[model samples]
Target chain A: MSKVKKNVWWLVFSLLFLLVLTVAISDQYYLLVSFLFLIGTMVPLYSRFEKKKIQSREIVFLAVLGAIAAASRVLFFAIPSVQPMTFVVIVSGMVLGSEGGFMIGATGALVSNMFLGQGPWTPWQMFSWSMIGLIAGLLKDSALLKNMRSRLLFGFVMGFLFGWVINLWSVIAYIHPLSWLAFIQAYIASFYFDLAHALSNVFFLWLFSSSWIKVMRRFQKKYGLLD
Target chain B: MHTVLNDVHPITSFCYYIGVMILSMMFLHPVFLIGELFLFILYNICQHNGAKMKQMFKGAWFFIGVIVIVNPLLNHQGTHHLFYIGRNPITLEAIIYGGLLALSFCCLMFIFLSYNLVITSHKFLYLFSRISPQLALLTMITMRFVPLFIRRLTTIKAIQKTRGIQMDSGNIKTRARNGMHLVQILLVCSLEEALQTADSMEARGYGVKKRSSYLRYHMEKRDIFSLILGAIILGICIYGKLKGFGDLQIYPSLGSFGLKGIEDVMLLILTLLFTGYPLILEGREWLWWRWQK
Candidate 1:
């Protein structure tokens, strides 16, 4: 098979393996931890073989990412009213592309949980935050940030969507009521935190996005990582 | 240091850890809390494995802090007065309850740390292989890679700092962007590592039928007894729970200790035994080693 075909096959196999393993475990904590490790290991591998530049700086970048991600949890505790992780996901997506963004967001949760300790709630948190990074990276690639208005608008929408998605997990794990009212209550409770994230995203895009793109381009040139 | 930590079977230790975790989640029984605290103190002071105990406690402090902060917030109601902030009231009952929860969490962590000390990953793999080969494989792989991912993350961060990336104090946006930059790099690195691991696993014929595990543990008479006792304790706890012996209630009267009657005492004893089985095994091993000395 061609290299592309080989990578794709590997991805498919690994993902299937993960799905089967998740189902088999039946314990959400084990499944989440297993997934985090699997993804943490797999994401880097995918990046290396994607005919990307293979930057030497990538390792350093990831470590810093992990620390920041870990720190975000502490920040959440410090300021329980805001969700800093959402902002982290968006920024990661813009810099690393979708796959990279997803890995960091997910793995960051895993690392945070190590200190926070594991529980049934981790898998949902991992998936929810990861989707944020993945979506941000995808949106960034699509030129949603071309203008200030569009960038801010996208940020606001993404922030609310992120909140809504995570709230879905809360509904599943807790709130056995599972009614529309329960959903709305969960959403409303999350709104303030989500609003913080959304405003932060817009501000982030306005302030450092151009510089971020420039840095990525420079890093790519210097280290020949991901074209 | 080595002898006291080396006696318990990994599976027994794992069971003990899981039992404690489940109990911590299900009920905040004060007896169990007290029992666990006493056990931790005993293990720390008397186990003859001072270094191991220190490490366990050091690692535990952060979790303790988390429990302290989160438990109060989650369980908002309690009777005894402490103070009140606006609508949210902090009660003495809540503080005591939170403290118990923290103790329970520490007990779970203690069990896990003890397991790590007594049961090497290789031993854990061997024990699991007998029951489920795929799960055994996955467990081993996860244990192996989690640390690697952490190490790699650290390396990535150091490298970024050297690259003159200003990661420190900025506006929320700048900080977030910096964080994203680091995450992007980490992801790329992780993907590379995963590919390498996959290649290695494939080369080694990991998923092949009839994989062999190096078994080092034999089921001795003591092991059998311990296992039997564990089964009985687990059975009784389940039976008692089903019978509504310790069904936690946080309502009107804040339901006075569920385990009030004689049957409740029996359930508490069984639960404590179940939760502390590993420590018991370890204690036995420590005694044996001391006698030999």
Candidate 2:
């Protein structure tokens, strides 16, 4: 475990080294921040996986759920941004707790992108989905998440938020100086896609969120997993 | 697997992507960018044939045209004014700038597509597993689970069809409900089976001792040859870049972009050899095939 721990720390430290290397080679701000933000999120998540002491049971559960999440993304391909990937992550958090939720979200994004084609957007997708899982996990104990109305509301809001975060990739890559006008224009244009995504998230949460939670909870109880 | 990239070590492939991406992004000079882009297309064609390369280029020309048409609309700058679009002046600098951007972006896209081809998922996980076996194993299993799950979904759908469950054709709500029901079945069946997987792993002594991956990828002679060749070409390009041979300045003004002399031409030639190394390797194989024939 300690040895495994060291590798994650190396992942964290290597970012600094990589930052120095990127700076020495290129004077571009976009390159610098992308590297920074990517590594910054990656290191913590790797450590979180380590700290959880997640066993084979939890891992298999996570992997299968992640598979379903990715498959669901494909299943809903015709519907345009309406998929249960985010919904699955959110419910995984509510049931399996925070880290488990985060794992499902991150892994779901990673596996889907592996099939879909990995690109600059891959890391950002992982980051966005992981955050949604993490946030949901943190709120699992609260009344807000426990209540169905608030959960649906949260899902709707998160739908829009996820799209906004994803929109950052285009801004980071193309639009230099990050002008407010240009940024707003891009955001405004993507509003419909974001709306569709958010609405779909709400739909999933409203419809199947409770049932998924029940199934996972029952499975975890039966196997004594994710404790 | 037949591609030249399939033969190179993952480390080498990783370096190639990073190098090409950084270069494609950093080198704004049309000479360097054009040469890079040309070799990228040539290499892509050689590796994936015209079909895959053309698939990549689908709508690419349209994108370049968009950049050429749209950049000047948004940005009104530079002394070399070309024409006007409504209220804005479309300057020569803006057009040139947009063209450079379009070219470099195409090169970048090629680099990414090549990466997708070269560093397949198992290789990527293999690289990561060297660092953290636990997380990498989880990710590898998750990646495996996707295709496996998809296959299972189709099987279940087929089984459901026998039972009068029509998922393939229905109203939107009905179709969506069937999808959810199919997913629910997947959840229950997979989770139930996951217990067996965990038991098997535990039986195999997983998580008890430090795990080590057994895949053996060594630096063969060709790997070493390509590595050194790659390093030398990369060194020269970076040195040239450092020496300001590949600079393409834009903004308040566009700077002179001329080849200084023989060194510049030789440098460009070196870059061609460097960028086109994949094509060289693939062509060598092609020649060997011809000789065999």
Output the worst ten-in-a-row residue range by lDDT, candidate 1 chain A.
A169-178
lDDT of each residue in B232-293, candidate 1, tens digit only: 77777777776877644543225665467888787777776665554676677768889999
Give me the displacement of residue A163 in model 1, in angstroms. 8.9
The digit string of per-residue lDDT tens for model 2 on A170-194 reads 6556544345765676688789989
Docking model 1 quality class: incorrect
lDDT per residue (tens digit) for residues A1-227 in model 1:
49857876776777677767776865434424444554654455444433443232353344445445555554445555354455556666777777667756766665566555554445657776677777777777665755667777877787777667655643433332134665666677678888877786676666655655565555546545444
True contacts kept of 2: 0.65
**DockQ for the candidates, in order:** 0.08, 0.58
The lDDT, on a scale of 0 to 1, for candidate 2 is: 0.79
| Candidate 2: segments with Cα more than 4 A from true spot | A1-28, B59-70, B84-87, B161-165, B239-244, B260-267, B284-293
CA lDDT of each candidate? 0.59, 0.79
TM-score of each: 0.53, 0.87
Total clashing pairs in model 1: 15
